[model samples]
Target: MRPVRGRWLSWLVGIAVALGFAVSALAQDEGYCGDEGVWLQILGSGGSELTDQRSAASYLVWIDDTARLMVDAGSGAALRFDETGADMAGLDAIVFTHLGAATTADLPALLEGSVDAGRKGLLPVFGPSGNDLRPAIGDFVERLIGANGAYSELSSFLTFRNAAGYKLSVREVSATGQRRWSRFSSDVLKLSAIPVHHGGIPALAWRVEIGEYVIVFAGSFSNQRDRVANFAKGADALVVSHAAPEAARGELREYHAIPSQLGRVAARAEARILVLGNRTSRTLGRESQSREAIEQHFTGPLVFANELECWGLPDKEDELP
Candidate 1:
């Protein structure tokens, strides 16, 4: 995502003033995933609404226009992904971290894309089974890919065949901290999933290991740092929410980690690069405090991502201790 600078910052001034400048985008830099390889792109970063500074959480990871897998379809993600010039047909699979409103809001737009592409079979979707409080994976599938699908028969040209729909494969992770890894086979990359703590919510974090490069995407959680630190330890990069700086743990005691907390966690796990997303809707002053706090904790390759900002490791083996 382009940094909300100059013009964009001016627009947010009247709205949240300094919030626009809090997460300054890193300088325009070329990315790497080992010898001209794959990379990860941030489509949206905000938590609830798309803002001048952030969009809801969504990401696209691919290896050169192909081998694509999307994580989360939060508000405006499909539209923003389209804007990134990614090929719809190139999408191999999709995964959701949880079923929260801000997390699963982009299903219709994606299923519609499937119909438009005349896809021959159901696209594979992976997520933990939902609980009483949240929509189960099956219900989520029915709402979007079932016969009475949410966007069923919207247009005459729209053809959502049973074969040309989402074929879900749900996997339940143990409630305890034990991690389960499932692999997604595709021509472009190998996708893996592990359940993480999201406050009694059915949430799953994903790690896509694509040809010598590994990137971890964490969902919103109350204790995500520990879960990811164990599951994604030593990954080349970690894509997570930028809730605040480490010192803001007092404010984030309930559900999210300040950047400093995230930084320390990433450092302990030996993750080389850090990308932050899913910022909350606090005022600009508070957001700035959190951002500054994160800067204090992390002294590695840090990036304040924006909508569609592409990034990756500078070298694959460099991730090794």
Candidate 2:
């Protein structure tokens, strides 16, 4: 009995130490979300190019223990997902903005991990409708685990279903200018998607709303800025790819938004915060360029995201609500 009691006390001491270490470590990464709100983490914030400066395109939205949504599965995102050390079973949905290699590359890896963990069927995916968007999701999934899926037999362990929980009914609407709404129950999060420009390919951008907080993710914009601006208006947080800067306006006129232009849109929309993702070396070095441009038009908080970085919604008390 004495020996058993000693072992139990040792276990208790170890647990207390682990808990203390956890709290201290998380102090920098976690914060108040409306006093008791959602927290967002950057699973990966790189662009198409995989460099020390960037990875690819991916963002992980989470609230405490619940994973709300995953946007884009870039080249290295699969590895980062594991590195995030977050709960995968809590991941309710995956939303791809386009079919760019950088965007959908890591999807198979993610799905496989789910299967290994005992997922029984299909997973919910939301994105654009046509060849570039819709077909890509199907092709990728089928290729990965379909009857002819690259790893069909192994893929059989999982299931694919619609937001309504029907397998055959999993219809991906990949139409541009079209909008779809999906609600995440555990966190009461709602997401609305619209096709944005990824070099005119079937790409999409999404606006996610949790309670009163709004987060808009604008994929590579090669099309109408006004169209996306309308969707981003008054957003609580706006994330845009940083492919253009005011200094290089002439070079970027074809497919991207200059930093100032991005800022102007955010200011016009009355967005509370701005996060610049999908950034490149040119834009990164002149990071001040974006700040200057955005400040020229808007005056709000701004963050230049890094790989594996994490952020959270402002406390409700922090807003004018």
- Writing each residue's lDDT as its tens digit, candidate 1 over 1-321 gives 222111121222223323443324432344322223566777787788544466688988757544388888888887876666665566777788887768778777765665545444445667667777676766766666455776555322233324344343443433334657665578657776666666667777788877777888876655653767777777777888765445554536456665666767777767776777776655233555555665576555555666666654455434222
After superposition, the stretches of candidate 1 with alpha carbons farther than 4 Å from their true spots are 1-24, 27-36, 50-53, 152-177, 244-252, 283-288, 295-297, 317-321
Q: What tens-digit string does per-residue lDDT give for candidate 2 at 202-238?
A: 7677888877778898877754546677888878778
Q: What local lDDT does model 1 show for residue 84?
A: 67
Candidate 2 error regions (>4 Å): 1-36, 118-122, 131-136, 143-145, 149-171, 178-187, 223-225, 249-253, 319-321
List of clashing residue pairs for candidate 1: 1-306, 1-307, 1-308, 1-309, 46-55, 244-258, 244-259, 245-290, 245-294, 246-260
Backbone clashes for every candidate come to: 10, 13
Error of 1 at 114 (Å): 3.1
